[model samples]
Target chain A: EPEVTQTPSHQVTQMGQEVILRCVPISNHLYFYWYRQILGQKVEFLVSFYNNEISEKSEIFDDQFSVERPDGSNFTLKIRSTKLEDSAMYFCASSEQTDTQYFGPGTRLTVL
Target chain B: AQSVAQPEDQVNVAEGNPLTVKCTYSVSGNPYLFWYVQYPNRGLQFLLKYITGDNLVKGSYGFEAEFNKSQTSFHLKKPSALVSDSALYFCAVSTHASGGSYIPTFGRGTSLIVHP
Candidate 1:
């Protein structure tokens, strides 16, 4: 089965540096999403992308966060200025036409 | 806003025994419920979902979930527990009210431990 793939399984960056998490969703999937889970916390939605634009975003997806589909298969989430609280496991997910989403292994972001 | 509730923080079961992970949901319109499992250091794996038809939905790794609209529940079940099944489980719900969006509102995960 085809699965969503993410690069840089683990990312470590300085507190004030910029970080970009990359994901390659399923080739045929139309809807892509970003979610994060703080250690020992529930997974929280960050943003959803479709048709090369953001469909919806949560409060956590503030000014520092931006998502771009730079290519057909690559979906990138960029954080302008990383904060300590931004350290979490970021996940990328995609779906064909249903609510059933397939998630990537996730990228663990650690801010120093 | 649609929401999901996983009442239990943890559930312990013995190997070879049946196990259940309960999930309840609140949605304004038709509910699209799902169950996902996560192993340590990994992402959430899709377990199963309930869209519109039958209430019982079977998914990967011998997992199944039953959707009860009257009670607003979508509980996941496995007939037999395995040590490999020990992991964190999450329940999620989406509604048509959100423009058929696939974004799911997830509940706090429940950790399941199967003791041998």
Candidate 2:
């Protein structure tokens, strides 16, 4: 089965530095999403993208976060300035229609 | 807002015994419920979902979920337990939100440990 794929399984960056997490969602899926889980916490939604625009975002997705489908397959989440609290496992997910979503292995971001 | 509740922090079961991971949800409209399992160092894998179904939904790895609208719950069950099934399980509820999308809210995960 085809699955979502993410790059840089682990990322370590200095505080206040810019970082981008990349994901290649299932090729045929039309909707994409970003979520994060701080260690020992529930997975939180960050943002969703469809039709080349943001569909919705959570309060946690503040001024610092931005997502873009730079290419047909690549969906990228960029954090303008990282904070310690931003350290978490970031996951990318996609769905063929709107019901079931397939997730990627996730990228563990550690902001020092 | 749609929300999911996984009351138990962890569940322990013996090998060959049946296992159940509980999940409850709150949603304004009809809910789209899902269960996902995460093995250590891996991503969340879709176990099953409850859309407009016959209440009993079967999924991958011999797993199944029963959606109870009256109780507003969707719980995952398996007839037999395996050590390999030990992992972090999450329950989520999705509802229509702004931007013409259905956003999911996840509950704090429940850890399942199967003892041999």
Candidate 3:
């Protein structure tokens, strides 16, 4: 079965540096989402995208975070001025409709 | 806001025995319940979903779940446990927010360990 794919399975960056996590959602998916899980914590929603615009975002998705469909298949999450608390496993998910979402393996971001 | 609660932090079962991972949900409207599994170093995989069904939903890897609306719970079950089934399990509920947007609220996750 087709699945969501993410690049740079692990990312390490210095504090205050900019980082971009990339994802390629399933080809035919209509809704895309970004979520993060701190070690030993529940997965938290970051943002959702549809029709090339943000549908909703959580309070954690503050001014530093931005998402864009840079291309037909590429979904990117950019964090400006990363903080230590930003270190977590970031997941990308997509759905054919808006009901069942398939998640990617996730990118582990380590900010120091 | 929609929310999912996995009451147990961990469940231990012996191999060849039955296993159950509990989940409960709170939603404003009808619930779309789902179970996902995560192996170490791997992404979360869809196990099954309960969406306006007959209350019993079977999914991959011989796993199944029952949806109870009255109790507001959807718990995952496996008739026989395998060591390979040991992993982190998460329950989620789908709901619509303003502007007709659908979002999933995930539980904190429960770790299942099957020992031989």
- TM-score order of candidates, best first? 2, 3, 1
Which of the CAPRI classes, incorrect, acceptable, medium or high, describes model 3?
medium
Candidate 3 chain B, run of 10 with poorest lDDT: B95-104
Better of 2 and 3 by TM-score: 2
lDDT of 1 at B43: 84
Q: Is model 1 an incorrect, acceptable, medium or high docking prediction?
A: medium
TM per model?
A: 0.96, 0.98, 0.97
Q: Give me the overall lDDT of model 1.
A: 0.91
Say which prediction, candidate 2 or candidate 3, comes out ahead on DockQ: 2
Which candidate should be chosen as best, given DockQ against the real structure?
A: 2
Evaluated at residue B105, the lDDT of candidate 1 is 91
- For B29-97, candidate 3 gives per-residue lDDT tens digits of 888889999999888899999888599999999999999988999999999999999999999998776
lDDT, each prediction: 0.91, 0.94, 0.93
Ranking by lDDT: 2, 3, 1
DockQ of 1: 0.68
Output the TM-score of candidate 2.
0.98
- Candidate 3 per-residue C-alpha lDDT over A1-112 given as tens digits, one digit per residue, 9 for 90 to 100: 8999998899999999999999999999989999999999999989999999999899999999999998898999999999999999999999888878899999999999
Clashing pairs in 1: none
Which of 2 and 3 is the better model by lDDT? 2
Candidate 1 Cα outliers beyond 4 Å, as residue runs: B97-100
- Number of the predicted model whose TM-score against the real structure is largest: 2
Where is model 2 more than 4 Å wrong at Cα?
none
